[model samples]
Target: MKSSNVFYLVYTLSLLLGLLCVIFVITWSKGYRGGFAWDGSAKMFNWHPVCMVTGLVVIYGNAILVYRLPFTWSSSKLILKLVHATLNLGALSLAVIGLLAAFGFHNKMHIPNLYSMHSWVGFIAVILFGLQWLLGFLCFLLPCTPLWLRAAYRDVHVFFGLCILAMTVASCLSGINEKLIFVLNAPNSTASYKKLPPEAYLANILGVLLLCFSLTIAWMLLKREWQRPNLHASALSDATEPLLTED
Candidate 1:
């Protein structure tokens, strides 16, 4: 099958899975005893945990698959280009689910301290991810011609990839606590909230740490590039060397 077709198929399946999971969770929250809490008051569905685990695996796995596509020449081979495209689309779908589930649990658990910050970060991450996905899809349709145009797309693609990587790292750091406690429907409370252990402090700490690291990395890379008078030809020859020699 064509990459596009495969992409649609996989994306559709993942979407359906997410929708079903959401429906199940919503129903459980509404009808089950105490609602989305870890006090053993609510009845958790058997499939919820399984589905979530599967989804996480798919999400991160797809990320690796997408970023290493053959179209890049350096990492991907022509024969596997279709697979790469499908995986890229699949990865985007998984990212959306990851964002949704992260927020949904946060709200359900009523993690007071992390609520607002998580909302904003999740929103921003989703927006950036959407842009990245669109640009990637466009690259699929656009012909690899007109040297300058192709170069522009390549640059844009790389920018989005870096953005995705950074945002994901940030989001993951922000959800570490939730992953450990809420993921298994484990039982505890934070501040005024009741049920589910209060681990926002840990997640927040991790988030800050990751933010500092990301900013520092960006600063160092930018500083090095800016120090160079001209980033042309021989100046970047070594940088382009690996890309040029890759088969």
Candidate 2:
């Protein structure tokens, strides 16, 4: 198949996988972990997974693909950059709220924070993600940046973006795994994960879908022909062009 055709195919598959992961995670949170709420209950902690999956996993994954999508090719590069920033901002905002929900629940319950592998990995991933966004905004969006430097930074930016996304995915998987183990192995737990309970199936499926989604995205990113036309060489050349002009 042509690269374009393969790209569209993989893009469609990636979206499906991402959507599936989000749905399954939400289902696992609400159905198995108890319904979500804002009160100082386990329900509050529930928002952690919902928001994290919706924001960091799904939205963050989608944000990385904005530049690679074909329809965005005609839009002005500035507009694209703003859209990218906007999406990352949306993701970041949800992630912050998600963290607050988790931490608030923990503090209220007198639970220790940052004790688990999931917490450590998640904290580091979020910090790196924030830094990545700040650097990208300064280097790519700010017109005051030297063209030569922006050109040099662009490749570095893409590389780090991919790395951060991988970290985010790993963080999410570890979190889901940790949640399952805690819930299923609790003293008053509803089901035995060792017995292949329904909740276990749901959580395990969610993790698998997350991996599929990440792999689909990674495949598209690795395909040089699938990258946006002007993204590599020409985008920086026309950096200061007037509004609505393609870079």
Candidate 3:
């Protein structure tokens, strides 16, 4: 298949995956009274998953693709860089809120934090994301930085961006499984995950959607046709211009 066709196909699927994630979260929230709150209840804890998926997974994925859009081909590189940074900042803000909600709920209940691999990996991914965003802003957005430095860091930025996305997705799946296990084993809950309840199916669907979203974003980033063209005269002037431009 043509690269354009594959790109659009994956893009459409990624959108569908995002929609499914929202629906699954809303359905679960409604079923369990898991609405957002600052009261440190289960509802407040619900905000963690919802925000993480929406911000870290969905919005972040789209932010990485902004430069790949055909309509942006003629747009100023500076504008695109700003848009990219702005979107990432938005994602980081949402993710921070999500983490706060989780920690607040746990602390209120006297639950231990960062005891699980999921939490450890998720935290690492968030930290790395923050550092990536900071470096990108300093090296690429700031006029004080030499063009050579920005060019040199472009590949590293892209590489780590994709790595962070993958890590987030994997951590999300692990978290879903962990939550399900806890809920199923709780004394008040009558249904067992062994029985494959509706919630179980919803969790499974959400995980699949997360995976699809990540895969689609990765494919789009890796596809040669979807990459942004280097139109800057300065970029072309470099004898050793990096093969990959910033997203």
Candidate 4:
């Protein structure tokens, strides 16, 4: 198979596999009233480790595609377009699957705090990413369109892309720290419930901090874009008689 197909297939399959892993992890965590211990609770379940490792791998693998997209083939239009589409669609799928895991699908399963935050934030980030992808696709697909509209679309796309990237980082860190899992079960933790380690608390704070940073960066980019002019601005300026007049 061609490189593109390989990339697409691996990326797509990773997404599906990651979805399954997420589902299984959520299901496994339901047994723990407080925070589930990897050694005591998760090790007993075959799916937990599989889900955690595979889901994580899938997320990282997808990031590889994201990284490759802009820099790898700066001169190749066709390849760039294909990679971009794959990342956008694949990210969307992961986001949806994550949401299902968090929302307690079928009412039989629910991931605790860490997983829940991971899911919700992931979904929001994906929503922002989808908007970014939609606007980008429109800008590229509609080259004959008005310059002003194209510029506006591109600006929106750039700003949202940055947002998605930030959210992606937060989601990944939350997943790694396993704090999101702890947060979900926080309300139920008591004398009868198992207490989480100090590490989880730190992770939760980090998650919040990461989210704040992401939002702050996104706002900064949006402000910058709003103040900047599009390529058409130069074109419009060039068309005026003042610049064209032969001194």
Candidate 5:
């Protein structure tokens, strides 16, 4: 397929998945608790899913794709890099707030924290994400850093960024399953997998949509034509060429 066609297809799927995620979370929250709060109650827990879907999934996915945007090709590389870093910082901030909400709610309810597989993996992913962002800034964005170091770590940065995305998606899927099971097995509950409730279906669809979103982003990143081209010469020079610009 042509790169433009692939980009459009993936972009459309990303939008659909993002919309589905928001819709499902809002619907689920309203049907269960009517609205969200942060008062150490179950209502406060609503922020968990909402923030995760909005920040970690939607915004984070787009941050990774910012440079691949065709319109950005004409922009200065520094401007694109700044935009990318800013979006990631926003995502990290939201994810941190979501984590705090979850932990606060659990503590108030006398529920243990970090006991489940979802928590374990999610915690690790967040930690890795923070480190990745910090190192990326220091190595790539800082004016004092040597150009060779940035060049050396560029591939490493890309690798870890994709790894974090995969981990986040997996953690989200596990979290959805865990929540559904907990709700269905609660006292006097009528919902079950065999006779699934509307919420159950919504959760299932959300998971599928998230998976599709992640896959599309991954495909877009891997496509050669969709990757960002090196439009300017590096700040450091080899034996044959003169340095033209600093990133």
Candidate 6:
């Protein structure tokens, strides 16, 4: 099959899987966990999972893929940069709200925060994501930066972006697992994850779909034929590496 065909096929699958991940998280949060709220209750904590998956996983991937879209490749570089930065800003906003919910719930319930590996990883990932977005904006979008210096930093920016994405995925997986163990296997809880209850299955499936969605995006980036051809140095600063791995 042709490269375009393959790209479209995987692209469609990535969209479907991303939507499914969002749906599954919402369902699991509303169905198994208490519904969402903002009053510093358990329901408030529910927003954490929903926001994290939708923002960090789904929107984050879309932001990175915007530059790779063949149709968009013809658009002005300034336009592309604005669009990319806007999407990332949306993602970061939701991520901030999610963090607030988690911390608020913990404080309200007198529960320890940042005690688990998931929390540690997720906290660091969010910090790095914010930093990456700021640096990318300063170097790429800011007009004053020297072109040569921007070019030099472009590869480094892309490398860290990919690393942050990977960290986000890992954080999500660990978070879901941590949530399951805490909710299902707790002393007073009736359900046991060891028995593979329906909620457990749904959350686990969500994790799997999230992983698949991320991998599909990575595959699209790694396919050299899909990259825009002969773009100007300014427009394709990260083009130095094929895998790109995009901000």
lDDT of 4 by residue, 1-247 (tens): 7545544554455455455545434443443323333332322233332332333234433443442332343334334445666656665565554444434431333334333675667657666766766766665444454556654565565555655676676665666455345444566644211354543444344445444434433333344332224435633532332321221
TM-score of each: 0.43, 0.93, 0.90, 0.44, 0.90, 0.93
Q: Estimate candidate 2's alpha-carbon lDDT, on a 0 to 1 scale.
A: 0.82
lDDT value for model 1: 0.43
User: Compared to the true structure, candidate 2 yields what TM-score?
Assistant: 0.93
Backbone collision count in every prediction? 2, 0, 0, 8, 0, 0
lDDT of each: 0.43, 0.82, 0.83, 0.46, 0.82, 0.87
Error of 6 at 12 (Å): 0.6
The CA root-mean-square deviation of candidate 3, after full C-alpha superposition on the true structure, stands at 3.5
Kindly list the per-residue Cα lDDT of model 5 for residues 104-216, writing each as its tens digit: 99999999999999999898988998999899888766767766777778779989999999999999999999988888778767777557888788888889988988998
Better lDDT candidate (4, 6)? 6
Candidate 2 C-alpha lDDT tens digits along 1-247: 8778878899999899988887887888788878888876899999898888888878888898887888878777778878889999898888899899999999989999999888988888788888889988887776677667766777788898888788878888898888878888889987766877899888888888888888888888787898878553555564444333455
Model 1 lDDT at residue 106? 43
Best by lDDT: 6
Question: Global lDDT for candidate 5?
Answer: 0.82
lDDT at 25 for candidate 1?
A: 34
For candidate 5, the 10 contiguous residues with the lowest summed lDDT are 235-244
**Arranged by TM-score, best first:** 6, 2, 5, 3, 4, 1
Residue 72 shift from truth in candidate 5, angstroms: 1.0
lDDT of 6 by residue, 1-247 (tens): 9888888899999999999999999999999897989999999999999999999889999999987887887676667878899999999999999999999999999999999889999999999999989988887777666667677778788788788888899999999999999899989877799999999999999999989999998988777898777646534643333222243
Question: Across residues 1-247, which tens digit of lDDT does each residue of candidate 3 receive?
Answer: 9766777777888888887887786677667545667898888898888888888998899999987887787766667778999999998998899899999999999999999999999999999999999998888766667767877887799889999999989989999999999997688887888998888888888888888878888888887778766635535432233323442
Off by over 4 Å in 4: 1-74, 109-120, 142-145, 175-247
Superior candidate under TM-score, 2 versus 5: 2
Where does the lowest 10-residue lDDT sum fall in candidate 1? 39-48
